[model samples]
Target: MTISNESDPFYKRLSLNLISIGLIAAALYIAQDILLPLFFSMLLAALLLPAVKFLQRKKIPKIVSIILSLTISLVLVFGILYFLTTQVLNFLDDSDMIEDKFNGLIRDAQRWVSQNFHVGIRKQNQYIHDTAEKIKTSGPALVGQTFLSLTEIFSYLIFIPIYTFLLLYYKDLIKKFLVDSFRNSSEHQVVTILQECQNVSQHYILGLLIEMTIVFSLNAAGFLILGIPYAIFLALVGALLNLIPYVGMLVANIFCMIITLISSPDISNVLWVGVVLMAVQFIDNNFLMPLIVGSKVRINALATIVGVLIGGALCGVPGMFLAIPGVAVLKVIFDRVDGLKAWGTLMGDPGADKQREKLKDAIH
Candidate 1:
């Protein structure tokens, strides 16, 4: 006869852990609208905390310091947004030219396809006409969905600032709550987790900003050297979009290529755009990321990818941006908590011998 696994301590613990994880995932998904803004605001407050404290050091009132910190952050954020918006509006102002260029590109594509693949122009036209008809049929639904998405975005914008301010204002209360929630035996662990989480947020967000600025400068320089129109706009767009992880740069590359093709009237410039962006990506992945963003978060590649995919599935792009930091924070918690050291290992890099040994000792 066999022994029952359910009677084992490991099995009992595993079951409880799985149930807790399932409940947490469901809660996050269901409460995303309320939680997402709060989470984002938490990150913002963490990033700006030093500035707030510095102002207080200068003998400024705490309330005024908080307002000043928030004001500077908001101005920098909205200034970039305003610039991007103006660029888009300027692009839209030349709609007739864009349409003409698009049609010309389509014609060029059809000709190239005919020559290379022996597809008839008439057949291609028929395929395009059918696709257009399908799009026309679904256009109204698409429009409604877009409108709803925009409304949701604006609502988040309103809530995020309010939440951020409140979070900063009540940070001490929250810290006290965390300390009181744990027993004396675990109070130090709770405090360690809080400090680690704050450090992770600060480093991760600050590193990303530095990375983005460098990337934007490089991209702008490359585009300017190639004499690409709207060079700065495309560079900024590409740099900002690259924040979304693996999928982002690919989309940015395609977008920049399409814009280059449309505006430059040089097919070769499209290829150069791809080449330049790829070179930047290589530098970013191999050099910049390792030195900057990946220094604090030692997540394994597989875990990062899986986390990003799961985050995107659960909460879309914002979730994708949050995934790495979320995982980093979770890893920190897991390493400190009993019975979860293995999970910390699973999320962390494999070749970190010192870290692995430390984890092993903690587990023991």
Candidate 2:
């Protein structure tokens, strides 16, 4: 006897699952404002945990260790900000000359576009003029909005360190509390999942730092070789932006090209700047990132991109930066659960699966 579609167990479970997902999506959308800060705090805590552990091993008191770590993090952040601010102020001070240089570069760009795409330079110039006029009209309001954004950023900056410190101080207690609070076969599974999440987070954070350092060094060297002004500032900005995944490289390249154009009106200099950025991206994608961050979290490229897009849609750049690690942690937990194993497989690297299969064959 054939079962009715609605009465079938598989169909019933599928409907329930879809409904559950819809509810979750709704809740997440509603709770996004609160979730953003909490998510950032959690990520900060994960990144700082290894440092906290290192300090603890060195016989530092937990409170002192937390303070030290927070201080170091803040100092680094402020140092970079100071450098960037100085570079920006200097650029503004030279605004007249920079504008002239940029105008020349725009003409060169229009010429290139005309040559390559058969586009009319007159229309391109008019488009550029219109864009400038729009910016002129909206500039003050945009500046005000930017200031408001900076204020919010500073608020989160203050909140994150405090939250991270508390998490580090109470991390063991928190883990114990979780394990003790739940008692059952499920509790053991939960504990295992938590451990896996922690492991993945720690690895991702450490690997990211390593990757950033490589990118920074490579960019700095390239910029300096190309005689790019404010090479240090540009390189630092590019490295930090690189943390945001796929689009970060494009953003960095645009910023670098703009800076180069403003610094030197010569088309050759701007071309060299583009070449440098391309070279850095090529090395980063093919060599540096793979060598440094390879297979650490077992996250696949597509999942990472999708996660970034979803995160950006939800909460902008911060969301984009946090997305992959958040998804990676979830994937780790899902892999340990029989019900979610398929999803875990979907999130994981195909290369990792191949490696596992090869290892299994060798073991047998």
Candidate 3:
């Protein structure tokens, strides 16, 4: 039943692949409301699978292992929430001081701008005054909305661990079903791809955790040294945001600048804070991440960006966070398929291609 080369079946197969991709995209779009939580659950399960397996190997009962793993996860979540709560309360307690410092900084900046550019300081002051009044009027509503958001977040938090444990407990059944449903020839390929996916996801998630820890620790130390108010809160926010990829660092830097301007009211402190952020970013981009993440997936920057955008558009922040590893898994599966190898190449790291070329030249 093999199609001979003269039949030119490649084009037909390619068309089929395109059709399948379109169908999958449409299905996902239609089902995203339910799919998002399932996707998050799967991701959490994937990240914790290695730990679960280790516990199993240690002769832990499956139920006990799931319980223990989820308990640790819950404790970590609560600890972070408690820390954030404490830091936020401290910030609120010093609200009046923060507001006075912010106002003084704004006045100084307005005066400097007037002196240098001959602009009307009074109009600028009026603008600031109007903005403050608007904020004052809307602040309570905004606070109410924020509380609602927090309630929703906690609701999601409660489900994630429960879902993660169920996934872990049923992982074997899921794998067995997948393998048994596939054709004999395809089963090995499917299993290999799944294992590779697990490895890729584990590396990405663990690498991200390491990266966040280092970034948060360094930023917190710098902020504390610089006497920045709410350093713990800001550092934690920055670390969590860093999981979003690409623009996360920029957001953290902007936040730090705003806090520095409002808290210190000193141009030197603001500039120093910016410098610290840049230094941390420089180290992260150049040294720490490369050493830690280290060629696990070999996905290119362009593909990564495109994947993140697609994921974000599909499922918000969780989608963005999951996108790269998801794409990597897709690429790995595509590479193993004879008809889809071209797509795998298209998604792969250009550096890998260069290395292949270099090896070919050496062989020649």
Candidate 4:
């Protein structure tokens, strides 16, 4: 008997799977406004659960514990915000200096263009003027959009905490509901998956927070050593941006380099800034993250990059932020489910797999 690969059941399943993915992607894009806040709150609630439990052990009411946890979190968040705001204000206070430096850079750029490309200063000036005019015409719409986004964020500020509190308070009910919904399935698997999900969420979030702190501290120290202006602000920005995985670090590095070039007298500052950030990143990828975060996810670089890009294309910034954790959760689920082992492997690091194989060899 001859078997044709294209006519196999596998091909039918593949087509169905591809169609399902497309449908899911379209649904996610459509429902992003509702779902983003919900997803974000779920993660936040997971992060807060341990604190809430700890407080409850001290004879505190669950409600009170939740409130306390929320308060502490808010205080920390606002404190950081205040610092950022102050730093930004100080940076803005030097607007005149920045303007002068920017003009010098522009003039130098125009001259270089003229020298190399035979484009005159007049053409450059005219091009810049046209750009500025276009910007002037469209500025109001951009400002309006920014204002609307900020308003939407502020609205979520109210709803997210409420959702988080409800999730925490009804954690057992949610778990029970899930278990009951899967009544036909193995209770053992459901329980295991639920427990693993909680563990992953808690560990991943706590690890991420710790990792960000360490990265920020290292960045700030490096910037301070180099006497960079607005060091704290830049460090915080870089560390936060670095949360998006590989692409984030590149963007953050470029941003810091631009800041250094524009703010400092010497171009050497830009190179030093790059060196410091790169060292910090090297430590982060190799040591700090591995130790603090643990390697439970095991996603490969290719999948990570692809996930981030697809996520960004789907729902912009929040989507990018959600992509890694979302993919990690999917991997965890796929690993537990029958016949999905191939998917788990596809999403995982080949290097990690090899390491596991080598360890098994040694043990045997």
lDDT by residue (1-364, candidate 2, tens digit) is: 8788767866666687678767855766678656767777777677777788899899999899888988887798788779779977876888898888777777888899999999999888788889999999999999998997898687787777777778888888988888888775578887888877887777777888888888889889988987777778788888889999998888988988878768874658778877877888888776565555655677889998998998788768878988888889879877887766877898888786565555457658
The CA lDDT of each predicted structure is 0.88, 0.80, 0.79, 0.86
Poorly placed runs, candidate 1 (over 4 Å): 1-7, 112-120, 351-364
Per TM-score, the best of the predicted structures is 4
lDDT leaderboard ranking: 1, 4, 2, 3
Q: Which stretches of candidate 2 lie over 4 Å from their true place?
A: 1-28, 57-59, 104-144, 352-364
TM-score to native of every candidate shown: 0.91, 0.82, 0.81, 0.92
lDDT value, candidate 1, whole model: 0.88
List the candidates ranked by TM-score, beginning with the highest.
4, 1, 2, 3
* Most lDDT-accurate candidate: 1
* lDDT of model number 3: 0.79
Q: Write the per-residue lDDT of candidate 4 for residues 118-154, one digit (tens) a residue.
A: 9999988899899999999999999999998998788
Off by over 4 Å in 3: 1-23, 26-30, 105-152, 352-364
Judging by TM-score, tell me the better candidate of 3 and 4.
4
Which pairs clash in model 3?
none
Q: Cα deviation of 279 in candidate 1 (Å)?
A: 1.2
